[model samples]
Target: MNTIEFLLSRRSVSVKLITEPGPDDEALDRILRIATRVPDHGKLTPWRIQVLRKDGQARLGDFLAGRFTARHPDANEKQVAFERDRPQRAPLLLVVTAKVRKQHKIPELEQILSGGAVCHNILLAALAEGWAANWITEWPAYDDEVVRLLGHDPETDRILGFLYLGTAAEAPDERPRPELSDVVSRWPQTA
Candidate 1:
């Protein structure tokens, strides 16, 4: 599909069976490069991508569970279960971190906007490649322990979102979007 068609047709695919999601190195690199071509003001690429594949995914889950357990020694069994199983939702999880650098010319907010644009581009690229992609971050996103375990300096790097990528076993249902007239506004005054 062309650029405009791809943008309009792209939709998030959830409930992916994901039997195999190991994109080849060449394809993966192309996707990463496309994902990074977002609007970056001041040329500050204030973001980083972490790919948790195979053994790494399991290790990350263990690290998070351990930290969660340590943080709340009095936590119930359900909380522990949630923490442990959170990482298994997807076969491959890509963590996007917004590394806000202290630059005199650019504000932290703009850096954050750039990181958000990166996440959107990733989803778009995945869709264009006929792969299923979903961006998500639940309780772990806000947890200090999780951030520390993920090797992010919370004071500088913020968790933009975790991208879950794979192939879908079932087609997803598309929902209706708001009409342009409902959202768009004209600049000049009309009678």
Candidate 2:
């Protein structure tokens, strides 16, 4: 497909449907390099990508479950297990974080947005690399303990998303996309 066609058809496959055979070390290296080549006004480069696979995923899952159980004593085994298994849902997970530089000429929002761009770029790059990918940020992304566990300073840093990349077990159906009229606009008004 051409560049425009590729962009128009780009969509995420479900994480549950994402199986093993994720990008190899070399492919991941290429994806990461391509993912970071996004717009940065001041070139702050505030984004970070943490790869979690196999042992790393298991450890993170256990820690997240423990934290969840500690916070909610009434949570049953099933509830805690959900958190525990989240990280292992896919063969590979990339924790995209933003270390916002405050008190700088670069606006905090801009720095944070740079990280957001990195998140999307990752998805695009993964797809380009012939891998199924999705970007997700559930409750854990906002949890301070989770950030701390990942060795990031929650005070100044934010978890943009957890990018899951792997081979697609099955093809996902295309969903409806917003119309240009609904999302696009003109700078100047007519009539």
What is the TM-score of each predicted model, taking all chains together?
A: 0.87, 0.97
The TM-score obtained by model 2 is 0.97
Q: Specify the highest-lDDT model's number.
A: 2
lDDT of 1 by residue, 13-55 (tens): 7734553664567767777999899988899899999888867
**Each prediction's Cα lDDT score?**
0.80, 0.92
Strongest candidate by TM-score: 2
Task: Kindly provide the TM-score of model 1 when superposed on the true structure, using C-alpha atoms.
Answer: 0.87
Return the clash pairs for model 1, or none.
none
Count of backbone collisions within predicted model 1: 0
Query: What are the runs in model 2 whose C-alpha is more than 4 Å off?
Result: none
lDDT: worst 10-residue window of model 2:
182-191
lDDT of 2 by residue, 108-154 (tens): 99988989999999999999778999999998999999999999999
lDDT of 2: 0.92
